[model samples]
Target: MSPEPTVEQLIAAARAGATGDDELALLDAVIAVTKDLSSHADEAVDQVVRQVRAAGHSWTVIGERLGVSRQAARQRYADRVERIREAAATGSVIHGRDLESSLSSALAAARADGLAEAGTEHLLLGLLTDGVAAATLEQLGATRDKIREASHRLFEHPTDWPGGGVPVFSAEAEAALAAARQLANERTPDCAPIIVNTPQLLAVIATNPGSRARRVLNHLGVDVADIKRLLHCYINVPRTPFGRRSRRGRGGKKQRDRCSFCGHPRSEERRLVAGPDVWICAECVALCAEMLAQPADGGV
Candidate 1:
């Protein structure tokens, strides 16, 4: 691919297009540079802030240089700064494509609802429609309609929600993201450079008692215990040593290989012990024995 145009080159082109009275050319140049600048603005600012702080600059001094109050500066950069530090303390990481899409949908959902910020509830609401988490959520009875009713009931909002700039993530939402990173690491240690996928993100949010996501799930009368146990099976294909599951046989008939107790699916040729209402797959019996051993409290 060709090298990206430099800022100076972009400015020159924009100026030339404007001076030449070519409206279309000018719009193109300006729009291209604006896209690049807007997309990378946060990272660039964070790097600069870190460099100056490392050089022993005080918040007041930095604020003075940036023409903003110290409190304003802290409020603007603190979450991202802390998250970056936290990530370094853990390991290199990033959101997988699926997770990214879910988050984007989360923001879109918040905007559509007329909310100013995307909270954990919004994150859960966003997952109701699409991505890897959708199937599990559907199985748990968290359809789009039900979640919308729950959220609307839990947090009442004005019907005429106003428009705004990009929505900021709530503190709980940020914590859920951090939690997702941790879960992703545990899910795939052998796999280097962990990528946080949809299932991991959903697991973290659903398990966090302090998050609104969990509250929404509870309001919807979901079985959180079942979700947690089932989330283990969605980690990754490499983690599922139970073997590949074949959904079809010679006659093209359907086959069932799911573990009834833990809801562990994606298995192949695994023997399942049939019960009155539930069947336990071989893998679940072997791996989830201890969990099954616990008191059947929480309806486990």
Candidate 2:
């Protein structure tokens, strides 16, 4: 029936060791839970900071924690982080607590499915949840069917061997997805969807080294540069073309080069000319007559 102790009274009691053992145990439990929650909160904070930094945060702070100079951390993680962030931010709401939960769930799912490092397909699953990034992906035509197909190709093909040959997820891959989720979540309405463009998609597949996804993407004639650009914009990172130095002079100077199929800069790898002024890429030529065979929009 007595009134509860006031703040000053409680302070005085604590100083005097006047609290009962049962009350102290309860307080200790509460303190323990608080510490656990604080630990979790710290992890969440670290994840967000790491994601943003990967998208191109300077290393002065990152280095200070690692006991290294800013330049050292930058050199160590700049490209690796940028690539990981780019991959993750592709049209998904993957940030803050949402990103952490999604990534943790994804890793769990991959493990349950007996998969190695979390792939793009796994990332797609993370995006299936109801969120801003998922909405963006849906709006931009990233359907479950396409994702499933992509995943199948990535997992089944002999060429799609994951790096390191480890059965567990790679830290890099997980971090990439986390960064991407954060970037996707952070995007504004005016931002474009981070769907990989044809060329860019092709490049991702190709650069995957031995990934089946890379092979499939290449077969589809997607562009690597476009995919990278989409990812860069989505992740809010500076866009820098990979292998730009190698691509230089691989095809002659830009002005003189002509597309064999259309006489434009965007050349199809395979070309055919049915007649003069009837040039087309092999795929286009095959589809041309079928498209022409269809009734016009205004036809009865």
Candidate 3:
């Protein structure tokens, strides 16, 4: 049997401009294999890198095409390629052709059904097959019935399809996903799956009353505060609380500071300087002073 091409060999070939028609054909084959494994474009590129290395493409040429130095390309993709190989060897849940087929079929079903968005419902349905995600869902106590109940609550009405319409991206879905992507990009630019999932969609709905999406999010244990944080991070929109003072500074005036304990705004009371970061009204100060004068444990 022929010896496998070393990383050094691949880098040398790529740098030497020796990747001719035969090499290109080999690269194309690798690309095709990778595409068969994943519908994502990035994964295709990853597969090409692996194939080129296997076919003796040099890291220098690979890095050149990838817009990175040979060292950088190797550092970034070498471990990933190794992981892919390891996964293939270990019969991991996420590896093999079966999982890919399941994803493709599930996506196809959602598309054929005319779903406008790909939510957790679609993902769950897709996971009905024996895949890594499915295993994770099962371990997480996600059953079809639970998912159905959550979906119904999310939609605010029981229906056969909780996530309605073709799985194609919708303006609303795209906006949400874009917002998530922007936030993720700020934090981790190379993050995958820029789209928001059903869990996120539901959480947003739950935070905002009368939001179908929020209901879904609530059902999934994503509370209003979490949603608010996500919105703050991604949408740049603060979640204003009901009956709370606005944070926006009004003309040159300091924003109204409220008492942490009583929820009383500074405008409502006579200011008493208790301590640094501890402003209290005269009435509250008196009350606290009186309470302090009593026995440490007998104020009740």
For each candidate, give its TM-score against the true structure.
Answer: 0.50, 0.29, 0.30
lDDT of 3 at 50: 69
On a 0 to 1 TM-score scale, where does candidate 3 land against the true structure? Answer: 0.30
| 1-300: candidate 1 lDDT, tens digit per residue | 011222222333344334344433343444433343322234334434554565566777656645689998788877766655555456677665556767898888888888878998888877654445775788777887888788888887768766867787888788888888877665543423355766777888888787788888999899888787656555633322222333557899977655543445535567776533335567655543332233322332
Return whichever of 1 and 2 wins on lDDT. Answer: 1
Indicate the residue-level lDDT of 101 in model 2.
Answer: 48
Candidate 3, run of 10 with poorest lDDT: 1-10
Model 1 Cα displacement at 104 (Å)? 0.8
* C-alpha lDDT of all candidate models, in order: 0.60, 0.39, 0.43
TM-score of 1: 0.50
Q: Comparing candidate 2 with candidate 3, which one achieves the higher lDDT? A: 3
- Give the alpha carbon lDDT tens digit for every residue of 1-300 in model 3: 011111212222232333354555545444333332222234446645666777788888777766689999899889877665564354332222323444454565456444545444444444445433343344445555565567655543223565544466435434544443344223221212122222223233234454333444457664456444322322222223222234448586776665422335666435644432434456544543442233322222
**Alpha carbon RMSD to native, model 3:** 21.1
**Least accurate 10 contiguous residues by lDDT in model 2:** 1-10
At residue 222, candidate 1 shows an lDDT of: 93
